[model samples]
Target: MSFFSVKGLSKHFGGLVANNSIDLDVEKGEIRGVIGPNGAGKTTFFNVVSGFYTPTSGTVEFKGKVISGLHSSKIAKLGAVRTFQRAALFPEFTVLENVIIARHLNADTSLLNAIFRHNTKAEAGNLARSKEIIEFLGLKDEQDNLALNLSHGHQRVLGVAMALATEPELLMLDEPVAGMNSSEKAVMVGLIKKIRDTWGITVLLVEHDMKTVMSLCDKITVLDFGEKLAEGLPEEIINNDKVIEAYLGADDIVA
Candidate 1:
């Protein structure tokens, strides 16, 4: 079995079909990008596969088990975790505190114990891992700062760090570098590569930046109007007529 795969996945909203029989796969330690024009069901696919929404039909498999009907938390506990398009953080908390809260998901302590601040080894472990993840994402300098005080780029990376705090085998990122400027985007690109190379974490992302997708992904999947239009290497996807028409209407998705 593949590390992660969606077979004949479809999502329906009343009379409208957002995704229709989309089949996709991501291998271990590979960076896979999913791209298409707006309203092409990219968001729907992500939600279904990540268990934010149960699919109307078909299955989502992760690490050789069927995870289609599981809740988002359950899926996350099983090591497939996702981040939102926006940086979802506790703005009142410090950077380290935010990640430590996320790390509590894997803690063996009860909510009461966590809330009252137990001095157990488990709590210490969570703090240690949270610090590790914060440093891994290059947010060590911002560790003591309030989440709301960080720049947009740092906030986005914080979101990713929270996801990594779950110790996910497959990290599903939604537009990881969406609103950043060139330099920030470059830093994010390098970090993403490092995440895969150093941690062996497979990444599956939905992004609008064609340049980033082409450069960062090992393979690309194109979705058009709720169906698979094309799937191949970044070079092939850039040159495909179908992908070109879907994004630019006249030029390539990479153009």
Candidate 2:
């Protein structure tokens, strides 16, 4: 079995079907990319995997467990975590605090212990883990900086660091470099590969930057208007006639 797998996944809202019977799989420690034009149900797929919406019909199995209808927090605790398209950070919190808060998802200490000043092994251990994540994300220098004070690129990195703090086995990123400049995108691409290699985490990313996706992904899946259009390696996907038609136009393909 793959590290994560979705079978016949579908989602609908009233009369509109946002996703229609999509099957996808991500092997452990692999970087898989999902691409398509706008409104291709890429975000919808992420939502289903992240538990924002339960599939109308289908199954999502992660690491051999079913996670189709679990709440977002429950899914997160199951070693599957995802980030948003836009940076979601606590504007009032320092970068360090934001990362530490994410680690609290797995904290074992009770509120009573903290309130009564009782020392617990879990609390101590969690602190050490958070510190390691801070260093891993290269935020040691800006640890004291408030989220609002950071540049857009750093803010995006902070958001990713928060998700990584969850220590997920499968990390799903939604357009991690959507609005980044060329240089910033380059940095993020390197960061992503490092995360995959060093941490041995599987990644599923939905991004619009075709060149980056083609270069970075081990495999690519293409969606068109909420349906699966193609799935293959980067070179094959790039040369796919159907994918070309979807991205450009049928008339363009004909011409």
Best by lDDT: 1
What TM-score do all the candidates reach, one by one? 0.95, 0.92
Q: Each candidate's root-mean-square deviation in Å?
A: 1.8, 3.4
- When summed lDDT is taken over every stretch of 10 residues in candidate 2, the lowest stretch is 246-255
Q: What is the per-residue lDDT of model 1 for residues 134-196, given as tens digits with 9 covering 90 to 100?
A: 888899999999999999999999999999998999999998888898888898998899999
lDDT of 1: 0.88
Checking candidate 2 for backbone clashes, the offending pairs are: none
lDDT of all predictions? 0.88, 0.86
Task: Show model 2 residue runs off by greater than 4 Å.
Answer: 110-120, 248-255
**Candidate 2 per-residue lDDT over residues 42-160, each given as its tens digit:** 99999998999989999999999999999989999999999999998989988877876777754445545434535678666666777788788777899898999998888888988
TM-score (C-alpha) between model 2 and the true structure:
0.92
**Residue 80, candidate 1: alpha-carbon lDDT:** 90
